[model samples]
Target chain A: MSTWSPSASRDALMARQQMYRSIREFFYTRSVLEVETPLLSQAPVADPNITPMQAGQRWLHTSPEYAMKRLLCAGYGDIYQICKVFREGEAGKRHNPEFSMLEWYRVGWTHQQLMEEVAQLLQMLLAERFSTLPTLHLSYAQALQSYAQLDVHHCGDQVIARHGQALANADLDLDRDGWLDVIMSHQVEPALPHNTLIFIDQFPASQAALAKLANNEQGVLIAQRFEVFFNGMELANGYQELTDAQQQLQRFKHELQGTQRSHDALLIAALEHGLPDCAGVALGLDRVLLHLLDAQSIAQVLSFEWQRA
Target chain B: MANYSSNEFKPGLRVMVDNEPCIMIDIEFVKPGKGQAFSRVKLRSIRTQRVWERTFKSGESLESADIVERDMEYLYSDAEFWYFMATDGSFEQLGASSEAVGETIKWLKEQVVYEVTLYNDAVVSVTPPNFVELEVVETDPGLKGDTAQGGSKPATLSTGAVVRVPLFIVEGEKLKIDTRSGEYVSRA
Candidate 1:
C-alpha cells in the first residue's frame, strides 16, 4: 500500500476550501449572481476549434458560455460559475481531457472593463492568501514587438516568415499564427514577471475570435480582448462581447471553415433564439492552482489524470 | 504501393520519408486558430543518428518502410565486433565497439536470444526485454534504523552493472530490474 502523510493531506484540504471560499466571497461582494447550468446539452458549440466529448449520442458542454449568455438575454445581469468542462485531445502539463473552469460574464461591460475586473479579483485573492500581489499589463502589439521585434498589427506575412527563419532552432515549422505563438511562448512569455500577473491586451482584429473591435487612442483598430498570464502560463481569456448577431454568425462561420471546421446545430439554434449583448471570460482553474501552488504539472493538482482514470 | 496516412502512425511504425528510413519519435497534433491543420512529428534517421522535425497536412499520405524483426542468438564478442547466429542457421555479425554495446554487453549471455530490428535488410537496433533478473555481487551490509524513507545504496550486479538498490536489499539476492528505466522492481 502507498503511504500518505496526514500533514500533506491537511494542507491540500485547506487550500481547496480557501479557493472555494475566495471565489464565492468575491462574487458576493460584487453583487454577481451564482448559477448552475446543464452539463449536457442537445446542441454542441458549433465552433470547429473545440471538440466536445460525446456521451450516449449527446455532447458534453464544452463551456457554460452559451447558456450563460442566454440568461443574460433573459436579464440575469452579472453572473459567474465554477464548473467542469470537457475537451478531447487536450492532455498535457497544462491541459486535461476534463478540467475545472471559472467562467464569469458581465452585462453591458466592455472587454476592457472585464479585463480590469479580472486583474483586480486575482490581485485581491492572491493578496488574501499570500499577503502580496504581482500584476503587469501590456498590449498584444507591444508584447510582440518587445520579444519578437515584429509588430503583428502593422507587419505583413513576410515579416512573420523572417521571424520564423530566425527561430529555426526552436524546431517549429513556420505558419502565420504558429510562428507568432512560438515566439510568444518561448521568447516573450518567459521574460515576463514571475512574481506578478501579466496582462496582454489589444490583440489584432484577426486573432480576436468572438471579441468586439474599437479604435484605441492611436486610432488603430484593435480587438476588445485580453489574456492573463502568470509565470509563462496562460490562466484566463476574456473579451468585450460582440452584440451584432449578424457579425457573430459570420465569425462563427469563419472559424468553422478554418481548422475547427465543425458545424454546431445548437449554436445556430441559439443564434436564432437571439443571443444578448454581454461580455464573458473563461479561466483555466487548474492552471491557476498550478501557479498558486508552484507545481509543475496539472496532474499534480488533479486527483487522477487520464492515465490513472 | 499503398500510401500510409497520419491516422495509421504510431511508435515503432516505420515510414519512408524522402525515400529514407525514418522512425517517428514524438508526434503531436498542432493547428492554428485559423488556417489548415497539420501533424507535427519528430523523426530520427535510422542510418545516421540525426534528429529532425517535419509537419504534414492532416489526412496527407506517405509510403511505409519495409521493416521487420528477427530472433538471433548471441555467440561471442571480439575486439571489433559482436557476432550472432540467426534461427535459420545463418551466422550474421555487426560491428559493435565496446562503447556501442555499453552496459548492455554486461547483461549479454551466450545462447540467449534477442529481438533485433532491421530496416531495408540492415540491422538498425536491438531491444532488450522489459525485465531482467540478476544477482547482486557486492553491496554494503544493511543497517538497523535505515528504514527511513528515501534511502538508497549502490549494489553491483553479477553482470558488472552497478545500480541503486534499497537499503534493505542485500548482496547475493536476485532482483528484477526494469531495463528501460534501469530501476529496481522487486526481489526475484
Candidate 2:
C-alpha cells in the first residue's frame, strides 16, 4: 500500500522545520559545537534491548554515544548532534523503530548540572507554544516513597503489586526489578505533574547503564543519572561520565553480556585515552514535538511512521 | 482453551485471571528504551464487576477466557434458575444468584430475545436490544391536543422499565424505549 503522499500535513511539516531551527538556535547561542558522526559503525550497543540493524558486516549506530565519547577524548569539548537513531522491536503510540535523537555532551559538568541545562532547553521550547512549565526536581527515591509508599532499596515484589493502581492486580510471581519498572512506568510517571517538567534523579544502581555510581546525601549508593518526563512521556536520560576504562568494561559486561565481556573494544580504548569529565544526554525529538504540537501520537508529527515508511 | 501474548492484548479481549474470567477494558503499551516492555491493561472481573489494572511483561502469555456470547430467547425462570434457549433450540440455565444475571433480572420480559454472554456453558450476562417496544402498563389519562413537545410524565412499561414520555402517551400505548439508557424514543 505504498502511497505518494506524505503522512504528515503541510502545516505539520512546516512546523517540524521551524522546530529544528529553534533547537539549533538554542545550542548555537551557548557555543556548543554541532557535529556529525558515522551512522554505521562496527561498535554495537551494550544494551541488549537495542538491537542494531546489520549492514554488510557493520552495525547501525544505536545512539552515536560511543563515537561522541571518542570525540570528547580527543579534546573536542562540548558538542551536540541531532540525527536518526535505530532500535528494533519497539513500535507503538510512543515508540518507533527509527526516530530522531537530540544528543549532546557538556565538558566539566555533572549529571545534576546537565539536568538543569536540559530543563532550560525544554522550558525554552515549551514557552514558544505552551506556557513555561516550572521544573519539579524530585529524587527517584522520594517519588516512589510518596506515590507508591515503598522503600526503594528494600522494597519487595509483594509491596509493588499492592502499591498502586498501575500494578494493583499484578501477578504475585513477578521479580523485584520487574515490579519496580512496572510501578515507575505506570504509577509514578503518570502521577507527576502534567503541566510541570519533571526531573527524577538518583535511580537504583541496577539500572545504571553507563553512569557512574555516587553516594547520595544519606550515604547510600545511587547512580549519578537523571531522567526527564513531560506531559506523561519520558523525554530524555542523562548520565555522569564513567572515565575509568577498567570499570567501564566491567559495567558493560555486567549490563550487556550477562557476566561475559563484549566484542566492543573501541569504547573501552577511547575511555583509556582519557575522556574528560563530562555529562551527556539523549532525548527523543519526536516525542518532544508531540507534546509541543499537542498531538497524541508521534506518527502525527513525523512525515512518515514505520508502517508508512 | 486459547493463549494470547502480551503483544496481542487489546480492549474487549477476554482472558482468564486467577481462575476467574475477566474482560480487558483498556490496554496501553508501555516500553522502555533499554528494558522490558509491558502491556498495561484494565480488566473487569466477569463475576465481581470489579475493575483493576494489570501489567504484563512483553511476550508473556495469558490463557484466553472460556467465554462465549450467543443470541438466546428468554424462557421462564423457575425459583432457582433462569432458563434461556439458543437459536438452535438448546436450553441453557443459570442460577438466579449468578453474578451475570444480577442486575438484568429486573428488566427481563417473557419471550423476549437477548444477547446472552455465557461462561463455561452457563449464562453470565445478557444485553437487551438497544430499542425495545413495550406497552405502557400504567400512566395517567392523556390531556386533550397534547403533542410531542407539550410535556413528559413518568410511565411504567411492561418490562418493569420507567421512562418519561410525552403527555399524550397513555396506558396500553406501545412506546419505543432505548434499552441502553431506558429513555423514551418514540411511539412504536
Candidate 3:
C-alpha cells in the first residue's frame, strides 16, 4: 500500500533465496572456495564505459573482479564470490544501480571450458522452472554476419555506422567498436532465438581489456571474452584472464586517458606477482531470477530497487 | 538554458531536439556486455505531435525545454481561436489557435475544465476531460426492449458531436460520452 514496502513479492523473495542456495551448492560440489572482498576500494575501474559510485574519498567496487584476481595471485585456487556490485546511473527496467553479482574463477581452464561449466550450473538452477534448451555458441563476428549481414572484423567504420543508424533509426556519432556494440544490442540480440542459451564469444579485441587476445582462424585478432544471453537479456560475461602485468597495465593506461580515473595499483601488483592461469565469469543474479520467475522487470526480483533503496 | 543528460531522461520530460520542444514518452537504458551504455527514447514533438525514436550515448546531454501546464475553463471560440480563462481564480484569459485545440474542438463545452499546455507562455495544446456529459439533441425515439439486441443508432449532442448510442436512447436525454472514442458511456 505504501512506497516503504519492497517491490518484490513474497514468492519472489523465496525464489531469490532458493537461487542463492543453488549457486552456492553448485560451487561447493566443484570445490570452489567462497571468498568475500570489501565493497569499498581505493581505486576504481579504468573502463570509460563504466562509472563508479563514489563514497567520500573511496569508490564502490563495480565488481569483485580485481580483488578476486588478487586472491588467485596469492595462491587461492578456484574461488567464487556472491556480492552486491555498484554502477552509477544504470537504472532501468532490467538494470539497478546496486545489484547482486555472482563472480567466480576456475584455475587451469580456458574460456571455452568455462562456458560448459556455466551452462551446467544454469541448467541445474533452472531445471524445475524452464524446459531443457540446447546451448548454442557463436563468435561475435559470425553472429553479426548471421543476424545483421555485416562482418565486424573486415567491415569499415562507415559500414558498421550505417547498420547502427538503420537499427537505431537515427544518425549516431560513434567509433567502430561503439557502432558494433550498438548493432549487437539493437539488432543481433533481439533477433536471437528464444528458449535457448546463446553465448557470443571472440569479441573485438578493443572491446575487452581484461580478456586474453587471440587470433581466429581467419588470422583476425579478437578478445577471448564471451557473453551469455537468454530471452533477449544479457545474463553474464566471462573472460580468459590476461596475466601479463605489463600488457595489463598498458591496457589500463590506454583506457584511463580521458576517463580521469586511476587504475588499481594493488591489482597490477597482484598481476606482477604472477596470477595463475584462469578463466572467470560474472553473472547477474537478479536477472537470472527474473528469468526463473518469468517476471517483466528486475524490480520484481530485487528486494528494493534503486528508487526504493 | 538548463541541460539534461541521458541519465536524467524519463517519460514526460520536455527537452529541445533539433531546435524544437519535444516530450520524452518512453526511455530504456541499454548496455551491451562490457560496452558503453545508451538511452533509447521515444519523443513526441510538441508542435507537430509527431513521435519518433532516438538513441543517445551515455553522458550525452540535451537542452531542456521550459513548459507549463494548467487547468482552464473553456469560454468561447472565434473564427481563428478558442478562448479560456484560468480556473485558479486568476481570471486570466488566453486564446489558443485552432491548431492547438485540434480534434478536442469537437468535445468543447462552455465552462468545462480542460488541461492547457503552454510553451514560452503560449498555448501549445488543449486536452479535454476523459468523459463529458452532454444532452442528446437529435435521435429516433427509444425502441422498447431494444437493449437485449445490442443495437444502436446515431445521436447528435448539444456540442455538435455525433456518437453511437443504444437504441433505447431518446432525444433530450443527458448522456455521458467518452471524449477519446466519441461513444455513449451511460445516462448522466
Candidate 4:
C-alpha cells in the first residue's frame, strides 16, 4: 500500500474547511437560511441527460434539487445547501464520482434576477478569497452567432448537422442540441473572457430541461437560465423554475421518452404537492476552488478522488 | 487482419501507416461537447525515427505495426554507419547520419548493450543506454576555494563526450549522465 503523509493531506483539509466556511458566511450575510436534507432518497428525479448513481436499489442524490424544491413548497423562503452529490462515469480532471455541490433558491424572482444575484455573489465571494474579481456577461444567442456563425435560436437540425460536418472532415452524426453543445464548449466557451467569471444567458427553450421560458423581444422563446464559467471551466448552472405542474409533468415525460427511462414517481408526487415559483442553482465547489487557487484539476481540491479511493 | 480502434489505443501500441511501423507516442482525448469525439495522437515511425500527428474518430480502426525491439551490443561506428552485433553473433549496421543520431553519438561506447528497433526486418533507429557512467579523461585542475562557487567546469570523458563537472570534481573521477536529456546526474 502507498502511504500518505499528514503534511500534504492536512493542507488540503484546511483549504476545504476554509472554502466551506466562506460559502456559509456568504449565504448567512445575505440572509439565506442554511438547510440540510437527506443524501439518500427513496425516489430521485430522473433526467435523460443526467444519470443517477444507484446505492443499494436507492438512488444517491445527483443534486439536492428535487428535495430542495419540496422545501420551497413547504414554505421555506430563501435557502441554500452545500452537500454531496454522486454521478457515475464522471471521473476526470474536472469531475469525480462523488462531489460537493452548493445549491441555492430564491422566491418571487425571475431568471434575470437570479443571474444578477449569482454574478454579485460570485464577485463578493471571489474578492474576499483572492482580493480581485474577474467578471463578463454574454447571451447564449450572441455566443452562438459569434463563434458558430449560426444563430442557435433560429437554426434547424439540418444547418447544425452541416456545421458539425464542416468542423472536422471525419463523420460526425450529431443532433441540433449536440452540435450546439459542441460549438459552445469548443468555440464559444473557450473564447470568452477568461481572466474573470463569465455569465452565459438566454438559452433556447429546447435546452431548458427544468427552467421556465419567456418570449424575447424578437418573439423567440428563451429559457430563463444562466451558466457561470471561469477560464473555460463550467462552474454553475441556475434556472427560473417552472411552477406549472402540468408543464413540468409534460417535460418529465418528454425526457423519459427521449432517453427511454421510467418516470420518477416520487418527484411527480413532490410536484403534486405544489412547488412555489422560485429560482435555484447548483455550483461545482471543486471547480470553483480549482479556479480560485489556480490549480489545474478538480482532484487537487478534492480530499480523495475515485482513482485514489 | 485484426483492426485496432483508436479507443483501444494506449501507450506502447504499435500501428502500421503506409507499410511503416509506427508506435504511438501520446494519445489525447479531445471531443467537441456535442460532436463526434476524436483521439488525437502523436506517433513515431520506427524505421525513419520521424514523428507525426493524426486524429481518429472514436470507433475508427488502424492496422498494427510489424516492428520488433531487440537487445544488441554496440560494436563500432565508421564514417558512414554504426555497427552492432546481435546475441546470435550476427552483425547489423544502421546509417548514422549526423542529424539522425543528433547529440546521442557523444555517449556511444564500444560493447555497451543497447536497444535496436527494427521495422520489416530492417534497422530503423538505435536507442543508447538511458544512463551511462563515464570516466573523466581531462579537465583543468580544481582551484583553491573554488568549491564554494558551486559552479561547473567542462571536462572531457574517455568516450570523447564533453560534460559539465562540479568544481570539486577532478580528473579520473567517474560521473553519471542521463543519455536522454544529456544532463549531469551524479557520481557513479
Q: Give all candidates' CA lDDT scores.
A: 0.71, 0.80, 0.90, 0.74
Order of the predicted models by TM-score, top scorer first? 3, 2, 4, 1
| All DockQ scores | 0.07, 0.38, 0.62, 0.14
Ranking by lDDT: 3, 2, 4, 1
Which is better, 2 or 4, measured by TM-score? Answer: 2
Model 3: per-residue lDDT, tens digit, A1-309? Answer: 238889999999998889899999888988999999999999997878888999999999999999999999999899999999999989999999999999999999999999999999887777777769779999998899999999778878888888898877767788888888888888889999988899999998988769999998999999999999998989999999999999999999999997768899999999999999999999999999898998999999988888888
**Residue B88 C-alpha lDDT in model 2:** 59
Residue A214 lDDT (model 3): 93
TM-score of model 4 relative to the true fold?
0.71
Chain A superposition TM-score, candidate 4: 0.92
Flag regions of model 2 displaced more than 4 Å.
A1-7, A48-58, A151-168, A172-174, A257-263, B32-35, B44-50, B66-68, B71-99, B106-113, B118-123, B140-154, B164-168
**Which residue pairs collide in model 2, if any?**
B100-B124
Cα-based lDDT at residue A258, candidate 4: 54
DockQ of 4: 0.14
Fnat scores for every prediction:
0.00, 0.36, 0.76, 0.10
TM-score of every candidate: 0.68, 0.85, 0.91, 0.71
Interface RMSD of each: 5.4, 2.3, 1.2, 4.9
Clashing pairs for predicted structure model 1, backbone only: A48-A260, A49-A260, A111-A240, A134-A196, A134-A197
Model 2 interface CAPRI class:
acceptable
Candidate 1, after superposition: displacement of residue A123 in Å? 3.4
Candidate 1 vs candidate 3: the DockQ winner is: 3
Better of 1 and 2 by lDDT: 2
- TM-score on 0 to 1 scale for chain A of candidate 3: 0.98
